[model samples]
Each structure stands twice: as structure tokens, then as C-alpha cells.
Target: MQLTKGVEQAICIIVLLSTQDNHNPLASDTISEHLQVSPSYLKKIMRKLVVQNIIRSVPGNNGGFSLAKSPEQITLLEVVESMEGEISIYPDTGLINKVFRDGVHTSKGEAVLHDVFNGANSLLRDYLAKQTAADLLKRTMEQSEIPVLNWNITNPSNQNKKE
Candidate 1:
């Protein structure tokens, strides 16, 4: 099943936060600018993450968002679920019963289909739960030359805020 754009953005936010020198909080505006997402949309996604305890919000002049847990403690599944809710890839819509004229045997067929889809969904959850944000961040760093820029230092407007 296809996940929402918010899921992708949440994952990216986790990776970005994990990369920070001290896991420093990142402003929503800064994140939106970096990810090329609209500030409003990003805020919605960020709010979900916050509710899940996957990320925490920092308030005040130099405040923003930061990870509530270490990257190693935050799994891919957690971020995905935070953005999209529980992962139920397949929901039995009872369409199978309507499609087959043999209504008597439809229950068996539906059961069989349900078992198959449930197995697949379980596998997906296991795979996602096995990987953590640290895993993604590590892969990102290894695959590309990610210039390390501390937001407090790089963003001049934020420099005075930190002081």
C-alpha cells in the first residue's frame, strides 16, 4: 500500500534531527525550506510526530523541534505509524461476497484472502520495525556527501536567538 507524503516528510525530519550535532531543535520554517515542503503541511506532519512522542517541540526564540528519543530507539515503523496511523495495508471490504454469486462459499474465500493479506501485512510491519532512524541516517551519510551544517551556526538569523 502507498503511504502518504507526510510519512516521507516525517522520515526525513527524523533523519535530519538525528544528524544534528547535539540533536538540536530545528525550526519548522527551516525544515520546510530544506525539505521543499510547505510550512503549513510540514507543521501538520510535525504535530503528528510530536503526539507520538517520536519528536518533541521546543518553545521560545531559539526553539523548534527535536527528537524525543534517540535515533536508535525510533523505528521506521514508529514514524510511519505516527504519520499514517496503524499499518493495515488490507482491509476486507466485503466486496468478495458481492463478486461471487456463490454466497455460501464466499466466507471461506474471504477467509483465505484475509489470511494471505494479513500475513503480508505482518511481514511489512516486521521489516519496518526492524529498521530504525539511525539506520536510515547511517545509510544516508554513507551513500552521499552530506555537508554537516549546524543550524545554529549556519543560519545567521538564528545565531542571535541562541545567544
Candidate 2:
């Protein structure tokens, strides 16, 4: 089963929020600007995250978005589920039963397929659940190729502008 682009953005948003200093909230505009994504589209994803309690929104002028829970507390699976809903790798459409008339063979085939798909789904979910946003952030930080960023700075574009 493939995940949507929203899921990828949601995870990145979490990683961005995790970089906030002094527990300060980062504005959606800032986040969108940094990621080079549309603010409107990011809002939709952020709304889902807020509803799932993955992130929180502030209402004042100095308002923005922040993590509702700690990075260590947020799981990759939680973010995935928040964006895409529950994961169901196999769609039980009953097409196999419809095409195959032999009950014994049909039942055996269905059982085997179900077992394999279920196992795969469970493995994926378990792996995701075990990996937290902090874990991902740490791994990312360990990579020399990726630049470590400070979300608290007045740096939405990650560029040096001439004054």
C-alpha cells in the first residue's frame, strides 16, 4: 500500500516542529516557506495533525503551530494514521471467491493470501510504531549530507539575504 504525499509532509512537519527552540511555535507560513510548499495545502495537513493531537495551533498574532506532544512521544505510525487513516494492505473485495467456484481451493488461496498480507501489514505497522519522530530526527542529524537547521531563527528560506 502506498502512502500519500500528505503523509510525507506530515512527517517532515513533525521533524520541523521538533527543532523549535524554547518550545516556541513556528508559523505555518514559515513552515511552508521553509519547505517550499503552499501554505494552503500545508494548512490542510496541519489541520489533520491538530485534530489527531499531533500538533497544536496558537490563535494570537504571535501565533503559529507547535507540537502537541513531545517528539519522543510521537510515533511514525501515529503520523501515518493521522494523515491516511488506518492501514489496510489487502482490500478484501471477494473477487477471488467470485472467480473460483471450487470452495476448497478458493478457501485455501484466500487463507494463504490473507496470512501473507496480514503478516506484511503487521510488520510495517510495528516497525513504524517503534520509530518515533525523535528517532528519525536523530538519524537525520547523524547524516552528514543533511544540514541541521534551527527552526527558532528568523530563517524561513535557509538563505542569507543582503541587507
Candidate 3:
């Protein structure tokens, strides 16, 4: 399963917001500069995030964007879903049907394959939902060695635990 660049960028944007020192919103232009993403594209992604209440936009001269809640409250799955709609690891039904019709596998075989795919997808989503943005931020802060200016606390360990 491949994660789109839009989804990747959305995650990055959320992480960046989580790391900010000030409660004041961050302008799209500033975010664009920091992440080296196009302002127009970032704005489109930001709009989706705002609509989902994952982030909120403040209006006015000093306004920008800020998280609606703490990073711990946001899950990676939520950020990904906000930008990508849904997580679909398996190919669409049309493709699957075509493959089966093309005699790539017997009907029984196809049924087994579908069951396996569904099980795998469910497992992946459950795993993803367990990891929150706060967990990601913690790992980032620990590995970078650069002092976290936004939050005073440090992660328990600098090394990431393997799956």
C-alpha cells in the first residue's frame, strides 16, 4: 500500500504544528517555506484539515493555523484520512473482479484472496489507529537531538523500538 504525497505532507504539517512554541497560528506561506511545499497545494490540504476539525484557521492579520486539540488527541489515521479520504490497501473491486474473470484464479481461490486482503487491511488500520501524533512527535524529538523548544519534556528513550 502506498501513501500519497498529499497524505505525507498532511502528516508533516500536523507534526510541525505540534512542535510550534507559540499558540499563534502559522501562516501558510511560512509553512510552505519550512516544508518546501507549494503554497497553493498546501492550502488545499489545509482546507481539508480545517473542515475535519483536525486544525483550525484563525482569521485576521495575526491569524494563521493551529491544531484544534493536543497532538496526543490526534491519530495518524485521522490525519491520513483527512487528506486521503480512506485507507484502501487493496485494489478496487473492478480490478479484483476483472482479475478473477480473466481466470487468474478459481472462484474459491478468489474468495480466499479476498478474505486475506480484508483481514490484512483491518490489521493495518488497527495498528495505525494506535499510534497518535504525539507518539510520532515524541520519536522525532528524541532522534533529532535538537532541543525541543516547544515542549519542556523529553521522550523516555532516544532509540525507537522496532516492530
Candidate 4:
């Protein structure tokens, strides 16, 4: 259950946006520059985010992208789902049986197997739903022992200049 590259970048974008004051909108190029990702690819990802209403894209010279809602109002799962679709922990019974030493197949409508999948999905959904963007930004700041503004560590030339 790993997040896709786009999903991961979206979360990073969310966290960076969360750190910004006044929900200031940033252009795709600025974001791509900071993220070290291709601007064109990032534009596609941003489009998905915009369509999902997780972020809003503004047009015009002074316009860019901004959070549609506050960081606290945004859930990590929502951001993930927006890019990756719904999360489900489905079981591949044939694969499961082949890997197990006992070689017992659980593909034929087994009650226990259904329960296992349901339980796993439920737990993951609950966790993801509970983790909001606000929490992520806060945790990252605390763990790094750095100011929120430092999230812009991708300031390219500056990093090289430091060396």
C-alpha cells in the first residue's frame, strides 16, 4: 500500500502550502523548481488536485494555486484519494495461498478472508482519515527542528551557493 509518486508529491505540496501564510498561491514553475520535478508533469498533478477541490487554480498574471480549505480541514487520505482513487486493502487469494507454506487457498468466498480484508481496509481508512494536513505540517516542523519557512529547502541556486 505505497503511495504513488504523484500522490507523494501532492502531499509534499500540501505540506508546503500548509506552511505558507495567508494561503498564498504559488505558480507551477515555482513549485516544480522547489520540488525538482518536471513542470509539465507537475501541471498534470496540479490539475488533478484542482479538480478534486483540494486546491484551487487561479488564472491571470497575479494568479496561481492555493489551498481550497485550511490545512486543518484537509485530510491526508482525501489528498491521497484525490490522486490515487479510493484506498482498499484487497486480498489476492491465489497469491496468498501460493506464498503460504500450508498452501491453503482462501479464494472460494471464505468468511475469514473477507473479514481479514475488511478489517485491514477499515483500519487503514480510519488512520488516513484522521491524519490531516495540519498534523503532517506540524509533525514535519517538529521533527526537523526547523522553522516552517524552511520548507522551501528546494531553493535551488541557494543550496549550491551554500557549498
What value of lDDT does candidate 3 attain over all alpha carbons?
0.75
Model 3: per-residue Cα lDDT over 71-155, one tens digit each:
8888877888887777777674655566567565656666787788888878877888898888877786665332223322243
Worst 10 residues of 3 by lDDT: 144-153
Q: Tens digits of per-residue lDDT for model 4 on 45-79?
A: 98898898888887788567888888888897788
lDDT of 2: 0.83
Candidate order, TM-score descending: 1, 2, 3, 4
Please tell me which predicted candidate would have the highest lDDT against the true structure.
Answer: 2
> Using alpha carbons, what is the TM-score of model 2?
0.83
What pairs collide in candidate 4?
none
Instruction: List the pairs of residues colliding in candidate 3.
Output: none
lDDT of 2 by residue, 46-71 (tens): 99999999999988888899889888
Where model 4 places Cα greater than 4 Å from the true spot, the runs are 91-111, 143-163
Q: Largest TM-score belongs to which candidate?
A: 1
Using alpha carbons, what is the TM-score of model 3?
0.77
lDDT of each: 0.79, 0.83, 0.75, 0.73
Residue 114 Cα positional deviation in candidate 4, in Å, after optimal superposition: 2.9
Over all chains combined, what TM-score does candidate 1 have? Answer: 0.84
Per-residue lDDT of model 1, residues 59-126, tens digit only: 99878998898888999889888888888878788889887769767978888898998899899899
